[model samples]
Target: MEYVVSHIPQGTACNRRSAYKMIPTTITIHNTGNPSSTARNERDWLTNPSNARQASFHIVVDERQAIECIPLIENAWHAGDGSGVNSGNRTSIGIEICESGNYAKTLDNAAELVAKMLKERGWGTDRLRRHFDWSGKICPRLMYDGGNWTGWKTFVASVDAKLKPKEDVRMPEEVAVQVDGKKVGVGEIKDGVTKVPVRLVAEAFGANVLWDAKTRTVNITKKEAV
Candidate 1:
């Protein structure tokens, strides 16, 4: 879940932070569409003013790592929704998954990152949207073209699985009881109760333990201190 933050400058033309604010109600996922660029390269390209004018996103994820190009609280011109008040650019956090390197691993990293964002924003998997959802463009083109939209569903499932709570596991430990600095028989915890043999404990404490067969009872006696 570790990510690199190489945020774009505050007043960069690519990210107009003063014009609009972002509340991040939704997470929009995209694919870089470049077959040879890594997340770092994408971040660098977005940071450059010459390349920043066209489009920008909050983060770019690859197989090995993720890089943040823009702050999540500000809008990046990624959604291609044009100039609208409720455009995805203004209300969503955009993430571009790099197509370079191991495609499957990159997708997994993106899913993990998105799952964390969902948990932080208190959003569900329902809030996950594809670039194609906002506009007719076939972004994350690999998932759409390769799996015929089924891949997107599987990705959402991965994010949902990550959000699930994990079960707690407890291992039993052997409990030991000591008397007068001497080791005695081991005790055990069962059904939330500690069980130990009374005779063993009494004998370990230098007490005389006797069994009465007639009444079926056990007795212990310790000598008084001199």
Candidate 2:
């Protein structure tokens, strides 16, 4: 859950100078499209004001870690939506998954980071969207080229698995037995069954405990009341 922050300062085309607040309603996923670009490279590119050309995303994820370029509170020019009040840029957080070396690991890291964001925002898988969802751009091209378009459901399932509550394990309790105002034997309650030492209980009650030699049985005897 660690992220390297290399914020893209304001007053650039990628990041607007004015502070624009947004209540993230959706999580948009994208691919860097460049095969050789790593997460750090993308972050650094976004940080450079000279490279700010109306292209930026909140986070870029790679095999090793995720990098934050734009603040979540502001709008990133990632989605292909035009310069208007588009939901993709105004109300959604964009995440660019790097398709550099070890893309499988990069995908896993992106899924984990997205799942963490969903948990923190108290959102569900329904809020997840691909770049294609916002516009007709074939972004995250690997998903389509690798025939992984259907795998989007699998990714969402991974996020849901992360959100599942852990099962509670209950332990057994110890039971104490007392005879004549004195504790005589200790028992354990496990799996709804109680186990105690018969000899200890008999001895506490002044009964003689004997083992039969022939029948292989335990016998307890005490003076009978007349």
Candidate 3:
């Protein structure tokens, strides 16, 4: 999903924005729990001086759009865990799914955002984590839905579907071989490597190519080397 970058000003209070550098290793999902705040509203509050709380996130996504309040290269105070090297706050890109309106749309948008991130970074669904995974807080509670873990599993499954890599057809393509700009023979390109009748191409260039079945080899001398 397309998101706008509206990062919090650099010199804000330590509560709103941290100075710690980050290279995100995972994605952490959370819910605002306010149930009535839009993505823009959450973003605004995050940057507002009056909203002084030690809780911040990278992205706040609602049905309409996603807003980035912090750079992915910087740490946010979303995870309740401490700012240790391995802490979620330092190692994860936090995404808060706004629960205010169009909850399903918000979920889908969040999933799309996460999938896009994973695809860009060559990550898998395994890199996704819940806020609860960092701290015992039941964040993203809507997906948790209580004790059974069913809803959480379903949400992860949806994200997995989005992030799964498409299979390549791997069809062999017939490629025409040439010698001195003249068509010689045809070769098949498969798995990114081309296979051709070497003897035909070699003879076209006035070079001898001999195949020895005993050694399973085709030896060619001076068609001039690459």
Give the root-mean-square deviation of each candidate in angstroms: 8.3, 6.3, 10.6
Best prediction by lDDT: 3
What does candidate 2's lDDT look like per residue over 108-223, in tens digits? 88888888888898888899988888887887787765555766666778778877876666687799978788888788898789888889889888788999999999999995
What's the TM-score of each model vs. the native?
A: 0.72, 0.70, 0.71
Q: Count the backbone clashes (under 3 Å) in each candidate.
A: 0, 0, 0
lDDT by residue (tens digit), candidate 3, 55-85: 8999999998999999899999999999899
TM-score of 3: 0.71
Stretches off by above 4 angstroms in model 2 are: 13-18, 48-52, 145-148, 169-226
- Name the TM-score of candidate 2: 0.70
Candidate 3: residue pairs that collide: none
lDDT, residue 138, candidate 2? 82
User: 1-226 in candidate 1: lDDT tens per residue?
Assistant: 4699888777766444443666778999998989999998988886565673668888999999988877788888888998577998888888999998899999899999999889987889999989998987887687785548888888999999989887665555578877877778788875578877788899777788999999999888995777
| Displacement of the residue 33 alpha carbon in candidate 1, Å | 0.1
> Which candidate model has the greater TM-score, 1 or 3?
1
Give me the candidate number with maximum TM-score: 1
